[model samples]
Target: MKAAPAAQQELLRLQALDTRLAQLAHRLNALPQTAPLAELATRDDAVRRSRAEAVGVLEDAKTELGRIESDVRIVEARIARDGERLTQTSSLKDVQALEGELVSLKRRLSDLEDQELVVMEKVEGAEGAVAAIDDERAAIAVAQQSLEAERDEASAGIATEREQTDRDRAVVAATIPADLLAFYEQRRVRGGGVGAALLRQRTCGGCTITLTGSDLEAVRRAAPDDVVQCPECDRILVRTDESGI
Candidate 1:
């Protein structure tokens, strides 16, 4: 293949742009925020689960407290009815039985009140736990949002750079002959994004292999306009003054 020396040099510039573009793409995919965002997601899920459990416990405590209060009300009503009977009764035995029932009702009320207190304490503790979890979740949310913003900013910068690189690549590619450009594109796809390299110090820069004897002679004998290919990697070898023919 034959291309002007200027065009050959353009290939080097194209390769550099392509390499930078690849690096930018890699950086975009491996954004620093990705790992932390994933970790936050896991933590958020755990916190939510904990909050839900606390809510369940609190609700149960409330229900138990309500039942205890209801029972206490019933016992108080019974004591009031028995006390009225004692005031109305003429028989001594009936009065004694009513007094004994009143005492029992008082004991039952005390027990229900004690249970209510315990349940109320549990409810309070559960509420506190939920509040704490909510606070933690809110903090995590703020961190996640900040990280997302940073990731977006980094992505926007990379996108702007890529747009400029694309424009430069288009201009450089257009200056080369159509056939040569097409050949370079084909090699770039096949050679893992590298199509050309400098032949410096008798070494194939593409594959870092030193050419000797006949291989060296062939490259040295080639015209300046001739497109030499690396014998090891088959990439176009763009020769320059430092080529060490």
Candidate 2:
């Protein structure tokens, strides 16, 4: 523990480097997907929704058309039964009543047919929309396929980078002393994994506060190898070329 200040500084530096490398690796691992892949996923969802809405519209139109047809059939049946009753009647008043009923039934049938025509038109329009949606879905599928292929390539590149970084981390870890590593680890946990910071302009890297004039003078006077901790934040301050001592 009574080693030269230079040795202690090197230890702090090694620990800082290891911590930074680990953080970078963690970030690379947590990437969601390739950017293109994420974009394609969003488009895929929208296309599916559009297709579903189109299909739903067509289905509703079909149901309405069916109801109209059923009503027409019922009116026709009523007309037939009334006509049969008229044929069996001999009274003039009864025949006149039968004629009036027949006329009303015919009008009902006409109205039902007109309503059915309107629904058929709607069905045609809905079918057209469904066709449009189908085409859009097909295009989206093709685009998604292309995007997925590109994303796979990008992801593979990122994976390769991650492996290389991991190897670099192993190399760095092997060179670090255990006791110094433990110190760094404890400080990192306490400072939210920011155990080391590059000293610049007499300010503490961890807390971004300028040291008191006395503290700055004391640190400046220390040997180049001295591992200096910021009194305010207790973080190991690694002097860089930018440090305005």
Q: If scored against the real structure, what TM-score would every candidate get?
A: 0.69, 0.62
User: What do the candidate models score in CA lDDT, each in turn?
Assistant: 0.91, 0.76
lDDT of 2: 0.76
Assess candidate 1 and give its TM-score to the true structure: 0.69
Highest-scoring model, TM-score:
1
Instruction: Give per-residue lDDT, candidate 1, residue 121.
Output: 91
Worst 10 residues of 1 by lDDT: 60-69
> Which ranges in model 1 have alpha carbons more than 4 Å from their true place?
1-10, 26-42, 73-101, 146-155, 171-193, 217-236, 240-242
State the lDDT of candidate 2 residue by residue for 12-48, as single tens digits: 5555555656665665555555455567778778878
- The superposed Cα distance between candidate 2 and the true structure at residue 94, in angstroms, equals 4.7
